[model samples]
Target chain A: MSRLSRFLKDNGISVVFGVGFLLSLIGQAFAGRAEFNEELQSDGARPVGFFEYVATSHFAVDITENWQSEYLQFFLFLFGTVWLLQRGSPESKEMHKAGLESDKDQRVGPHAREDSPRWAAVGGLRQTLYSRSLGIVMLTAFLGSWLAQSISGAAALSEERLRGLQEPVPWASYLLSADFWSRTLQNWQSELLAVGSMAIFAVYLRQRGSPESKPVGASHDATGIEG
Target chain B: MRTIARLAVLTLVVGVPLTGCAVPQDRLEAVRKATERFATLHTAGDFRAACALLTSAAREEAVHNGGPTCAQALADAELPEPGAIRSTDVYGRQARVELATDTYFLTSFPGGWRISAAGCTPREGRPYRCLLKGD
Candidate 1:
């Protein structure tokens, strides 16, 4: 196959999700703008334009709150998998091979093969850093988005207060407010539930060709047996 | 590897420069001017001109409560006396201007900041009680 075809085939999943993310985000912008304008109309304010509405705290808070939760979900899942195990779920490590495994299994230091990553072959701080980079990045993204959510959420709440002729709370005060926690915990619980459900469901479920699930014929008790 | 790329995104939004994008220099002036004009007109008993400085909702509320016309409603509402403008808080399309004796809530219409409510007093743990409020 040609290089472009190979690249497309190899990266199809990432590409599909990336495209979907953009499309959905664009859809959200349009939908959010409509609702925002309706709100403005009810408040006797002039309707905002597309780009204008996008820059509003209202829109920023909505997007960041969701982003933070997603990152938190991914981060927790990635980090949790290291020492976590589920007997028959592909989402978990094999019960017997849990807890970071042996050095040879991870191919670091002297056990690194020729095809191994440079950090894995060099083996030290770089190796350790490379090994945990995915989880670290996810954790960082979760924290960053959570920070963004708080900032924007406070601003949005303040705007709402001003609109309602109530005083705007300071950001520090808003940190302790129910609105912030509700936005956070609501998204978190849903994501946690989704990951929790997926992990357990894979134990009894069979997706014949999907790596996420065990083979159709695989025993329900077979741990971490992927397609 | 793309730290700069991520930083740019964060600066633009992840850290959200969306709210209180305080273009304070000109927008504050506009808010102050609209508010001061409303106060001056109301004090001068030019209720017609004062009524023009209100949001459509506020105007409608006035017309509904005490009107045959908006000016007559304003004349009847007997909102508290406006004092000198103290401070203005502008957030996106909304603003809250604190005057010496009263507080006013405004919204940025295409025509500029218009009073949505005036003669507002804070009530702890609740929305402000405004003498002249939008519907």
Candidate 2:
């Protein structure tokens, strides 16, 4: 294959999602700017330009709130699946294989295959870190995004309060406010529900060739068997 | 590890507005000074000077209210003394300065911070009612 084609093939999933995210973000900017300008006009304030609106706390908070929740969902899933078992769900490991398996079972240490990751072949802190790296990274992203949401949300809330002739709150106060919790919980509940539903649905559903689903001919009780 | 680091860097980049885009202290101080000057000009009976400090929108509204000029309208408004500055809060291009006796809302323009509303009194669950306000 040509270099361009080889690169595309190797990174197709990321490229697709990256492009989709950019398009969606652009769409959000246009829609958000229009809605923001409408409210500004109604309040007798000057309308902001598209770039200005995008840079505002109003936009930042909205994006960060959703991003944080998504990272939280993946973080929970990655950590939860390590010990939790769902008998019929391909999303989970086999029921008998629950909990952290032996080092040999994980192809670590003496049992490491020649193709195994270097850290997996090592024994000590590096191996330990590599084992939980997925969960660690997801958790880190979750915390970072949550922090971003809080900061941006506080700024947005302060602007609204100032517009209403109320005193603008400090970051600590805003973090404890109903507005902050409302934004967080609203996104969180949706993400949690979607993840839970997907886990349960995968037990009975078959998506043919998708790894997320069991094979069409597979039994409903078959655990940890991906198509 | 590299992927995680890249993800973190990307998030921080996106978080620029949240992490370090706070309204600068210098900008807040400039607004505070402008507010004090406005109150000082009004208290000194320099209505024209005070009127000159009003935002264009506010000045136009003041002029159209009753008097033919912003100065005449402001002089007729009978605003209370602002006294010493108590506190000032600046968010983005907007600011609110609380004086010992009154509150004022200011908006930043290319020229500088100008009074959008003066002689303001807060109302519960509503925007402040002001003797001089932009339309």
Candidate 3:
């Protein structure tokens, strides 16, 4: 019991992310396969096996479009925090604080009393970049998902032509079509609405002890920090 | 007196039509009827019967393409019941009729009209593209 508890305590975040990813992927496979078969049966077409279906871009676009939007939300949030502030909201920094805080305030460089990360002290551009490293990683992930969407969307388009007993359109043309944009924008809208609403709502709402919200006792006008 | 009056009315109706020449059946009406019959068979999941109604050229093409025997092909299909005509759109010799599970694009054949293609289901994993035929 103790060993399991210790392992979970030390690796809870990793475990959560890993399991969530696995379940999400499994869900995509099942739903996508069912929808695919339904369409095939309607057209007097053959149904593809699971692994083969996964290899096609139809699945790729289905997954990547959502992934890109999620990463974009986090990336935007990370960078937006730098200059944007909402008074009394735990999501933002103080109203007037802008750019990176001081090294001493951040507990690194010459201000380190010895427990500081080795890289934090070995400063210059490395330290400068690390200051906003969260944003960088999120932005990189967002770009990756976007690229995956385009590649998969093209493959899906070609498959459609083949089924129609017509010549397949090239990947380049598919990328520019209304179908692709419509799918992308539809997903993007939902993500944007969620993020935008949460940012504004956190200003007035309070959840005791939760880092996502200010403490109930905190003043309604408080700009940053957990109340 | 009643018998005479009834006979006079019957003669009036029969004589009016025969007086000149009989009216012709509109070509559009004949075409529409054929299309309706085609859609009815398809929606009932009777692909063989439906294929039998096709023009000879289409039947040849289906066989040449290595498609399943018509009955076998229909076994996996999902369709509305027979006698339901969702919609019918005609353009001269070509027409498109949307049934519950299939949208058939047909051409005027010697027998009447035969389906050139059915556009209903999208390609597997590619829901945006309609799959009309076997890959």
Candidate 4:
């Protein structure tokens, strides 16, 4: 029992995230198939097999749009935190201390702890680059997801045009069209709203044992540091 | 009362020219032919030729798939066979047709009656249950 508690304390987040991701994927497959079948009936076309629809850009676009927004949320939050601060919010650093901090504050070279990463101790450009690696990776992933949304979105739109006995547009034209931007903007707005809420809510909210929130009794005026 | 009667007469005079021209059946025929030709090209696996016949909406879709040149249909490997119109029922600018394997719903375009949409199903448990194709 003691060992189990210790293991969960160390690896709780990784487990929850992995399990939730897999379950949602399965749910999407089932729900997507149902929706595809509805369209098929509406078009008078035969309902496609489950796996067949799964391979198409229809499913690809659906999944990528979701992934794009999630990555966008994370990427924006990571970088935004560096430049913006809410003085009393645990979710943000102090207002006066915006932007990159000094080397000693971040711990580098001889000032590094014994357990500090090798790159942090190496200083120079390597240390500087490593300092922002999390945001970089998240931003790269968001860009990739957004690109995939464009490609897959074009494919889905083309299929609809073909089915409608209409001429298809060029990829460049589709990218510039109202249809593509509408889809992107709709998803982006929701993610922005959610992230903005989190930043504000975490200021006075407490989730007890959750690392996402400060201690239950912590002052609403507390800033930057976690419980 | 006299002014009101005069205004009513004037309104009737203006309403006479308000009706728009109806779409001609010949135009619908031309659009149907164009759509059929495109479908024929697709079934024959001559995607480039088929793509050329595609309406603006379909053409946009094809271009997104890679260069609007490939014969891949339905995003699945299964190839749909080309079919001919068995019979057509035209009403004003709208028409529904029964093809060899599917039913097509059409609307008149500038050129002729073109299929606005088409749906296909197997022979048994066929598309008839949910379609408006035949009489």
lDDT of 3 at A201: 86
DockQ of 2: 0.39
Worst lDDT window (10 residues) for model 2 chain A?
A: A158-167
**Predicted candidate 4 versus true structure: per-residue lDDT over B26-134, tens digit per residue:** 6556646765775665566676565444334434443454343333432222334547777654432334556777655555445544434445443442222312121
Which candidate has the highest TM-score of all? Answer: 2
List candidate 1 segments past 4 Å from native.
A1-4, A41-45, A123-125, B1-25, B43-47, B63-81
Error of 3 at B114 (Å): 24
| TM-score for chain A, prediction 2 | 0.96
**TM-scores, all models, native as reference:** 0.86, 0.90, 0.62, 0.62
Compose the digit string of candidate 1's lDDT tens values, residues B1-73.
3896577556644346445333558998999999999999998899999999998889999999889999999
- Candidate 3: regions farther than 4 A off: B1-135
Q: Report how far residue A137 has shifted in candidate 2, in Å.
A: 1.5
Candidate 2 Cα misplacement greater than 4 A, ranges? B1-10, B17-21, B60-68, B121-129
- Residue range A121-166, candidate 4, lDDT tens digits: 9978998889888888678667766776776676666555444433
Interface RMSD value for candidate 2, one decimal? 3.0
| Candidate 4: TM-score, chain B only | 0.46
lDDT for each residue of candidate 2 in B1-135, tens digit (9 for 90 to 100): 589758656865455445424777789889988998988899899999999999778898998895798899999999898888888887765789988877999877767888988888888767788888887
Model no. 1, DockQ? 0.42
Each model's DockQ score: 0.42, 0.39, 0.01, 0.02
Q: Output the lDDT of residue A44, model 2.
A: 62
Shift in Å, residue B42, candidate 2: 1.9
Task: Give per-residue lDDT, candidate 3, residue B19.
Answer: 18
**TM-score winner between candidates 2 and 3:** 2
Cα lDDT, model 2, residue B100: 82
